[model samples]
Target: MPSYYDIDAILTDSQKVPCTFEITVPGLGYLDGNPGEPIKEGTKVELPLWLGEMLAVTQNNTNTPTLSLDLPQCLSARVVNALKADPRVVDIRALAPHFYALGSRMLELFDEEELLDVLTDTFKRRAKEIADQAHHPRGVLGEGAEFLRGLDESERQLFRSAHESSKAVRNWMVDLKK
Candidate 1:
């Protein structure tokens, strides 16, 4: 997912260069509801990409179009509807003389091994790519540079001789391992 945000301008009575300042904000965040913050009325905030993208967008906005981050929502039916339709949610049902029913063994149906296998496969593919790059190094000293031809990294910090900048291509591969 990609992070996305919107910019806003707030007009204030000030003595500086401009009365109105720019406000930028990441569209997606944890959405912690707090007192007295501005929320975009109908925006549906998504996860993962929202945080990082918001920062980049705000940085690009500079002083004007300044970011107003993590704003709070106003009281509205749209907000109420979003909460009610949340997939994991169950509405509370009020009834007199209602008794509990037996629970189902649904939790046991989870495929833990399949999940782990997918994760492991992804990591292994990444590792193999790094290792291959190490074994067959490429660098920029020339088209056929003599960088990291046979070297692999052992630690997070990569060091290469200044004379062998061309030989440092292996670090690029080693970086994948990290």
Candidate 2:
């Protein structure tokens, strides 16, 4: 089965925002930013979210990293602009999971309803276009149809209405053929 979620994009985006956490165990290796020096126990340090999550999971003793709200707004704006410019050219399927995760985190951290609303609207519009393309394959959407088939329930919900409309169109076409 094709994978719908873009793991690479998620990992890349996660690394963009650094977070601070304290090491509770000794001799874990160098912190991402503070290289060459081994991260000693009880040493507070800043690390990218991707590395932080890794260390936290592996060590099982580090403090939970506090996410910094430094990039979500800018990232959201960029995503919105890119989708607005050309929904067809841009790979919404590739970025949808990352954008959704970041937007959810931003909402929790800052409660910025307006930004989240804009992001959500932009994503829905892009998803609608992608769904339309799914009915009539072209360009990336040709391959994207397979990717769309692999979307998780939550992600699929974004294009649910569009998918339903497309289904109706397909059924009508079938009837006409008969």
Highest lDDT: which candidate?
A: 2
lDDT of 1 at 126: 34
Q: Write the per-residue lDDT of candidate 1 for residues 36-99, one digit (tens) a residue.
A: 4543334333222233234324544244333322311211234334333441121111110110
Backbone clash count, each prediction separately: 9, 0
Task: Tell me the spans in candidate 2 whose CA falls farther than 4 Å from its real position.
Answer: 1-16, 20-29, 32-69, 72-97, 139-178
- Can you give the lDDT of residue 122 in candidate 1? 30
**lDDT tens string, model 2, 42-62?**
555545555554554453433
Off by over 4 Å in 1: 1-31, 36-111, 140-178
lDDT of each: 0.28, 0.53
